[model samples]
Target: MKNAMPRTLDRLLASFLQCGTWAACALIGAGLFVGTKVLTAGVALFILLPVLRVVLMLAVFARRRDYLYVTIAATVLAVIAAGCVIGIRLGPLAG
Candidate 1:
């Protein structure tokens, strides 16, 4: 039971990431073929993927009842969010 569940979770996570990657690529390609706003959305998805991955990690740890890891993951997520906000505030670095 224990071994089976963890393996299942791992597989689920892998499948989620794989599908997400493929979907994002398809959107980006279609955007390139089509229009401006679609291309912008595709680019936004590319930016959001890492943050989404961290959120997924936080959910996984929380599900497993691993409090310490949950805390660590949450902290990491917060830092990422903060960095994004700071970057937006600062605007372009070089030009």
Candidate 2:
């Protein structure tokens, strides 16, 4: 049972990533014919993939009552959030 749980979570995470990637690719490809909005959506999804993965890891750790990992994952998420907030505040001009 213990071993099975990790495998299941791994599979779930893998599938989620795969689906998200494919969806993003499809949107980008369609956008080539449709417009910039769809392409932007795809780009956003690509950027968000890592964040979503961390969120998934946080959820799994929390569910398993793994405080150490939960805290680590939470910290990573906070950092990512902070970076995004800073980037937004700075705006394109900052770059």
Candidate 3:
């Protein structure tokens, strides 16, 4: 009974994981925003695209279990890299 579950530890782990996830997302978003072909498009894509990708990947993670955390982490990193390669441009979003 004593080892049934460690509520405090569970809470701590959850917090750490969530914080890490959010930070990863924010960094990727910022990088993507800065590096897009169009500044305005980049900003919009940075904010929205990752959110969508994360949501979709969440289900995949749930099924795979082991890959969830790693996938999320890798995704954040990919977004950052993608941002850098996107470049810059001008159009309707600039207004």
Identify the runs in model 1 with alpha carbons over 4 angstroms from their true place.
Answer: 1-6, 92-95
Q: State the lDDT of candidate 3 residue by residue for 5-80, as single tens digits.
A: 3464356456655665566566656667665434444455446655555554555445546475657756776776
Task: Write the number of the candidate with greater lDDT, choosing between 1 and 3.
Answer: 1
Output the better candidate (1/2) by lDDT. 2
Q: Count the backbone clashes (under 3 Å) in each candidate.
A: 0, 0, 4
- How far is 46's C-alpha from truth in model 2 (Å)? 0.7
Query: Which is the leading candidate under lDDT?
Result: 2
Write down the TM-score of every candidate.
0.79, 0.86, 0.33
Off by over 4 Å in 2: 92-95
Steric clash pairs (candidate 3): 36-87, 37-87, 37-88, 37-89
Per-candidate local distance difference test: 0.81, 0.93, 0.55
Ranking by TM-score: 2, 1, 3
Question: Relative to the unseen true structure, what is the C-alpha lDDT of residue 46 in candidate 2, on a scale of 0 to 100?
Answer: 91
* True-vs-predicted CA distance for residue 5, candidate 3, Å: 6.7
**lDDT, candidate 1, 13-56, per-residue tens:** 78877877777788888888898778777777777877787788
Count clashing residue pairs in model 1: 0
